[model samples]
Target: MEALDFAAESLDAIWSEGAIYNIGFERGVSEWRRFIKPDGILAVSELTWLTERRPADLDTHWREHYVEVDTASAKLALLERQGYAPLGYFVLPRRCWLDGYYRPLQQRFAAFLQAHGNSPAAEAIVEERRHEIELYERYGQYFGYGFYIARKCHYG
Candidate 1:
């Protein structure tokens, strides 16, 4: 994989939406912190457990797929530990996923299945996506995307 290059302390702001989970949350924040100037900003949207108690199935699904999922308060604590001050956070509305992402993706998946004659491998991938969407639909009250805003601290 090709590496990304960014000068240390060069960025005024770094924004990651939905993709940070791929590298793991804390690791992503820690790695990107070095690229942001002191007093700069970092904004990230992460999958978060909204309720104190989540259903076992929901918990298991995320534990298997996104082991780093946690609460908003936990993320705020993490920000402070990483030398950033928590600014604010908001839960992204359900439409943001259903309309903005999964709906369009479902359409694309349908087209792919049609064009590819619904091969087993491709159908399995589509089914997995469908299952994820269903989980969000059913358990949306327990979890959601949280948009976190923080500023890098200047320790002068």
Candidate 2:
């Protein structure tokens, strides 16, 4: 994989859309800040845990991605240091499990095959569905995903 200079390109893209605000949730909040104007709005969907637990298979993916998965507290602390403030946080851990994500997609793909018949496109869809199931089964050991919201503090 090649790394593009995302920040440089983002800074260079000049366009007007009236009070532009950058919004991204999950995983790359640190990098997303670089693309926004210092005084511009930063709004994001965020996830927080009112409670914590030892997630299953954390070590495998953690080593693979080299991500220091921060708790909600640590994420807020890091945002504060960067002059961003937490705006809102909520925990809506799906009461269901990975089957919730997987089963629907599987059903959709099967329906697609029935509708489309055995074309190459249909076969590709089947393959993709199989891959998704394998990936979710392997990696989605944890039963929930969290959401978060934050804003860039106005310093002026």
Candidate 3:
């Protein structure tokens, strides 16, 4: 995907949510750093390991799905390495999974299946999602969307 080539040292901050992985955590933070003014903030939410150790299945799942998935400390260190000073961090709440995303998505499954003609492919996709939700429900303590907020350490 094409990245926006913003004017250097023009922005006060850059915020990204659940999307930076489209390019990659390191690449996104590094490339975007040049656009921020002195001490400007860079905030992003990324798939992160809540703990260094996790169950084999959960570990395997994330590794397979997002190879860049790592602990929050690692993410923060990566930010620091990219010239950002850590300011704050938090995991997206459980409701962000249940009440916000999965519940709403589950509500659409039937219609989605219907629209897709209930084909095996569509069903398989739904099943995979269900499996993911189940895994989260069981091992949420090990992984989640980690919100990282930091400021640029370099001045223009």
Candidate 4:
């Protein structure tokens, strides 16, 4: 894999939206912290549990897929442990998931299938996304993307 290279404490802010899962939440913040100046900002939109309790299926699916999926309170505490001061946080609204994201993605499925020649693999990908949307429709109240805004502490 390629690497991230930056001078230590050079950045005034780091912002990541719906993409930090590639490195995992804790690892993303920890690894990137050294690249941010003291008092620099770190803003990220991360998958988060909206409620403390979840159905077995929901919990199992997330833990198996993204181990760091956690409640917003726990995520905030994690920021504290990572040398950042929690500035603000909120879960993206349900409409953000349905109207803004999944709907738009669904709209592209037919063209994607056409471009891919309607291969089994392409169909499977579409099915997977459909399944994901169904799960959200059923269990939306339990989890969502939590947008977190923080500032690197003056002293770690």
CA lDDT of each prediction against the hidden true structure: 0.91, 0.50, 0.92, 0.93
lDDT of 1 by residue, 58-150 (tens): 999998999889999999999999999999999999999899998999889979998889999889989999999999999999999999999
TM-scores, all models, native as reference:
0.94, 0.46, 0.92, 0.93
Q: List the lowest-lDDT window of 10 residues for candidate 1.
A: 1-10
lDDT of 3 by residue, 1-156 (tens): 246868999999999998999998999999999899988999999999999889999999988988999999999999989999999999999999789888898899999999999999999999989999999999988988999999999745
Clashes of 1: 0
Against the correct fold, how does model 2 do in TM-score?
0.46
* TM-score between candidate 3 and the true structure: 0.92
Clashing pairs in 2: 45-148, 46-147, 46-148, 46-149, 47-146, 47-147, 47-148
Best-to-worst TM-score order = 1, 4, 3, 2
Q: What is the lDDT of candidate 2?
A: 0.50
Worst 10 residues of 2 by lDDT: 12-21
